[model samples]
Target: MHPRHLTVNRSRSSSTSAGSASSCGFCPQIVQGRAPLGQAVGRWSDRHRPGAVPEEGNPREHQTPSRLRSQRARPRATAGRCEQRRAPGAAEPEPDRRALRRTAARPPAEPPRRRGRRRPAGAAQLAPATHRAGAAQIPCRGARRGHRRVRHRHHGHSSGPRAYFCQNDHVTSSKTSIPRVAIYARQSVEEDQGIRQQLDDGRKHAADHGWTVVHEFSDNDTSGSKERGPKTDWARMLSAFDEDEFDTLIVTETSRLTRSLTDVLDVTPPRRAMRVIVIRQGIDTLVADFQLKLLVLVAENEVKLKAQRAARYAADRRKVGHPTSGKTPHGYRWVPAGQRDERGTRYVVDEAEAEDVRQIFREFLAGATLGQIARDLTSTGRLTRKGARWHSSTVRRVLMNPLYAALLPPAQPTGQHSMAAIDLEACTPGAWQPIVTRDDIVAARSRLVGVKPMHAGTARRWLLAGIALCGVCRKPVKSSRPVNHPTPRKDGSVAPAQRYHGYRCHFSRNGDVIDEFVSELCIQRLSQPDAVDLLTPPDDEFDLPALHTRRDALQAERKNVFALIGSDPSRLAAAQDRLEELEEQLREVDAVIAKAAERHPLADLMGVEDVRAWWESRTLARQRAIVQLLMTVVIKPVGMGHRPRRPQDVLASLEITPLI
Candidate 1:
């Protein structure tokens, strides 16, 4: 195809009426016989009329002073210009006016080669519009002032491409004297460590970059082995980047921030427009380089490998039957292997603390209450490992520990209950030196039952005193009272002191001589019933018979629910959940019936004696279950001693029924 080219001139009339088409390279002409029209013919034509010019087949009779005359000369390839080279002098009689109007348009040429140095291979591509914008803003063509021009070394063949540096004005370009920086750190171990090193390096790098450390985020004791590292608070950093957190991120090294390629990629998107200066890698993300990517990959691989090795070590420990590194059991101590030489191994136990433990067991065996022991320890200047006074709970924990008994040599013990031994085996014991033998421990535990009963005034008051109500009065009451209130004194003085209390109704007693109520027995009764009922199942006749009636109804509901799932799944899901819960309950009821047949001793008893036997041998839980199923105890407020006399009218009294 022939090369395409064209020229255009906007001013070519009045000043120079001469037309020269032959000199223009793009136009070609061939002559055909043509003559000037007569005055009559010319006058009839619009070309010779007023305000008309020959250029556009119009001639202007008078020039308008206010109007600026402009002409556009369009080159045309015609039959006349192609012939009569020298004879066609005198501008070819200004070319026939009608001939130029039929001119054809020319095509544009192919674009030229790009200017300036070629960008390095593997370097990021700059948009043309961005390059244009940068060029337009640049004051000079070659380089801007205060910028250091770097002549990058060309590797491989010189014929390949020229290396270039982005003009860096690191010494200047500070609109604000604020420092721009990225802080990074990590902990190879789970505990917070080596964090200070990363911070120091980051601060130093920021200073080197002439940026102030404006904001900092750190994740101490966090490992990149899983996801997050000690220093990378990614969410906060990302938000700050969106808000333009800093001029640039200044990190000691990319690895300090992340050891994952994905994490490295995350850093760039947050502040894509902002710069990132990684000091250790010597990378300027804004400028771009292959090494930056390579370094990120290297850091990521190292993190993954470190995590793998740590995981492998953990697995190996489990295989070797060693506990994973963490807290030790209550009685045992973490014995560092280093402490073990050729001699016996040294434990991490605090000996003074361990001695107090020995005294507690001995005191318990000597008939001290756990609470009394706790108070004694506190009063006698004994402090716990935490430097706190002993609590009954803490004392009990020490007594119950089997490590003390495990220290016993294998032998039958005297007066040691087998029940205590059975309980000991249930609690897994840790390997530790025992201060007392199993026999001594059993003897200590036996004292728990034989200890002197708490006197009325000796024991502490119940926390629920005067708050928990008596079902009889529908009023709060005290469960017990001091010894002085137990019976009247023979000396004719008031039987109980004023402080010795009772559960008296505010309405009935005129707030005087309030009677102490039976509280501990009530708690023991109610709690047993509540717990047992929770464990027991409804009678099969009651539950299963009701269920059989609902089964078909539920199946129909389920079908309707399945149809609704496509249009309104949320409602359907709720219905399905209810159905599942009901089904689960039915299964539980079946399980309860099976359990009752196996464990309930009442299966063999009969009549009133059967009832008495069931009541006698049944656990508190089973008693509660039976009461809930077969009886309803209603307490109605009435005058004292007004018991229900008739069976049918069981007023102000318990109503018992066989639920079967």
Candidate 2:
């Protein structure tokens, strides 16, 4: 604590002076001066100094400063003492001329001899304004710590400026002339290498430099590489620095300050002079060759390189149908290496959650809306894997994921396209077994997104535009208006300018009439007793005898390649990759031979009593799937003049062949 102002009365008594001095020992004896105290009671700096002014007649200014007798020992500090004597080489106080007016020569008390560096002879005898104001207004050279404000007053003296003194027990040299320091430590994530260790090191370094630790700031699990994320502590440290709270900063490393070049400039602000010590990097911001900007660039490059390596590793894992290191998917939990099954996959199915996943797929494929399914699941006692309420987006995303169907999304040179572009017929199998099959997921996903985009970017309007092929070119045809140019209708209104084409076999027909004819055929077929047989798979891929022969040839070939690579590292590496691919193909063939019939589509159509109304509700994509599954529409060529005049003509030009 520093003071207000100190004053002394103009009385001339030794007892009164000694009694007032006993309050605090900084100024050993109080002044009993005869001069009236001026309005400025405390003013001592390089401009104005405290010195003796002799009376008009007596020449007491010539008195020699007192020296301690050799017999007297220097005083020692006590338990509760706050005696702060001035430093070594400071000007001794002139004996009060008023005291000398009566007694010719009374020697003053000797100040304690403190051991410390002396002020140079050229140094100003007045206050330096370095340490805070001490006794009176003369600055003390004692340590500026462990201080408390104290006041000492003499009785019977009422008219003088009141003085406050900053009292501390131990008065040594200006030992507390140390710089104020603030430590800033940060770690981007929670880990063993944390801010605690950095702060410990910063405190130790500050102690070694004789700096007073003023502020300790830390940010844990908060990134410093980018000017993103919350760094409230870092901002506060800078604010305090700018406010002149402390002039020095300490850190465990250069990168801890910042990894971004733009943010690095803020650490060593050019406008304000400051000292920043990077402990581990051995770089000081005050040094001429600090190059903080260059260090930031290096740190930034290292961060980017590390990120790229992680992404490349994850991409490689995904290429082989393994998870790319993230939250466990809803159906499974990650198992450790040795505890996993022989195939070395990390996750095992968690049945309680898997049952929920299966339910979502079943209800969604059974023509349940996303919102209805989400509400029903949310009403149950069970919770999602993340312990969250089910939502329409959550259900839709689950349906879009290929993982449940035991297939990996196809990897493009960049990222793969959206789910609508996925080839459900040629899906790549994953290491895990299926919870929902390919047909079920594809059907459910199609209902959510509707029909895939048209090849020519036209909006989908007809039920079987893409599904029904051009019989001659084997190309899918789109709906087109009968007239290329706008023509007047029966009501004298011109037809719309935009036109579309429909499925053809070198001959065109009314698209609306063709759609109606196909819908009627589908309804009549589902009305038959043999509709269930329509779910059976084609026999082309069920030829087990040929598949077995191919499998034998592939195995023999792989064995010969294996024998040639024995004991050679480079060749063995190649052979392993080759064998793995062959094994994958073999597994596929085995799966195809045992593949079950897809009955989900028929299951959806099973219980609906009103067949026409149910058919009307289906999307064009699902309707097309059903029609392609049940039959093929073949259209044959007819001459140009073969334009249909009657509804019976379209029947003559069309062919509906049922494969089952």
Candidate 3:
């Protein structure tokens, strides 16, 4: 087939003379005289011929050159037709009608390469072949034609065409950064072995996951069952979490962290972004769906079960006439149950301590107050079971406990006990050896009841009502006065009036006289320029080196005990006993250190130039505190028929003992 040509006309006008028709590429001259117009004219002429004119002599003759070119461009009725060429710059000839028809009938080219794969040979062609005319090569119009092949290839596959999509850009392999982890370990009992094991397990888990262990937070002897109180290290670890110090937390198990569901939910829900890994439970909170909630519930149930079991064991032990709990009473010490069928231990009277208990009861029954008994015990260098100086409250507790009486009180009434009374007849002899007889106990109780004044009330206005002690009787001075008194009038007639009030020692000086004397003494002493130095003594120097050494030694001993705990079960009791002793000694050392570290508030007050103004500006409670810190005022009994007339005389009758 011959190449098809499309002639583009340079001239704007379509009309041309016979001479121009011979030169125009698009307007071809008819070789023979125009045949009949009907016979020469074909399909191409009917579709593309712009204008036609019939000749004057014949109907086949045409006057316009465009109509003549249109006739020559038609597809030949027979195959024997010759091809013609035209010169450049002539009127553009009509695109070869025969070439257009042949091009439309030819098949299109194949689709573009997809996903780096070659198209199959059997695939239907979709793109058009290229066509060229003169120097310019025209791309095939079939390529632009509406074909379903390209559209089907794009939308048919669910994965889409991989070649069109860059996997490196659109589809990514996730890069997971190693998470920083914090390991937390806790034990409810004072055993370092449990803590050590927890920490070891947690670290191993972290190592397996290739997580960076940033911190290890541990709490010893800290209970997880209760949500109250401070969990020192646990609190600190949470704070660290808030600061984004770690992305993951590793624990030996959930129970070590918290046994309360509320605490678990409260702590974990807000930190959903952080991962929690439990080594034993094989749970990761980050990926956990419902498992985390289930684990928390399990831990809470375990705590409840443990508590129930403990309560049952305690009740059973109490039924068997054994101490139901671990705490030893003040006069006794714990002993292993030697042939007793009780679960663990029994209480035996500590004889040396029991003697002290007997002395306390004897003194109380002999009319000594709780405070006086405490002072007496303290004077003899006796300490309580906790190894601290005795307090009046402590003495009172010992006196009140029914175990020390010949009989014990009925079991604490369940629900409510409105009718329960002190059953003196229920006294069981040899139930426990009594420290004091029933008569002595009754006498002491009767004296306590009798001493309770019918008009017992607080003294709000009296400055030293509760604090002032009678120097002679060694009892609290009561604020009192006569209800009525006679006031002398100018007419020499006496009228009733309220009497002046004062602090009274039951057997000695009047309350008014003593109050005035003490107040004036306190004001005068504090008004001195050197009063501050005299009132607040320098704190005693503490030997920190010795304290630190002692603390280190105790810590070393604790470690040694912890080491022996696993090897010797018999040694456990001894280790615990020694640890308690060491703990008390450590407390004493800590107290000394704390005292040295404290700065007295009086030190700040000392810098004031006007001491009286400073004292007056303070609250009454503060003023009383200052007075108590400085000295103790003792008012001596007045001599018979000797009344004081001067401040000096009054001062001489009183004793001021400086404390600082």
lDDT of 1 by residue, 489-524 (tens): 697666444443333333122112211122222333
Q: Please list the Cα RMSD from the true structure of every candidate, rounded to 1 decimal place.
A: 24.3, 18.2, 27.8
User: Residue 377 deviation, candidate 2, in Å?
Assistant: 2.6
Candidate number with greatest TM-score? 3
lDDT of each: 0.46, 0.60, 0.57
Winner on lDDT between 1 and 2 is 2
When 1 and 3 are scored with lDDT, the better candidate is 3
Ranking by TM-score: 3, 2, 1
lDDT of 1: 0.46
Error of 3 at 573 (Å): 54
Most accurate candidate by lDDT: 2
TM-score, cand. 2 vs. native:
0.36
Model 3, 483-559: lDDT tens digits are: 55566889999876776665666444555665566666667777777766764654555666777688768778877
| Candidate 1: RMSD to truth | 24.3
Model 2 stretches astray by more than 4 angstroms: 1-258, 266-295, 311-316, 338-342, 410-429, 449-660
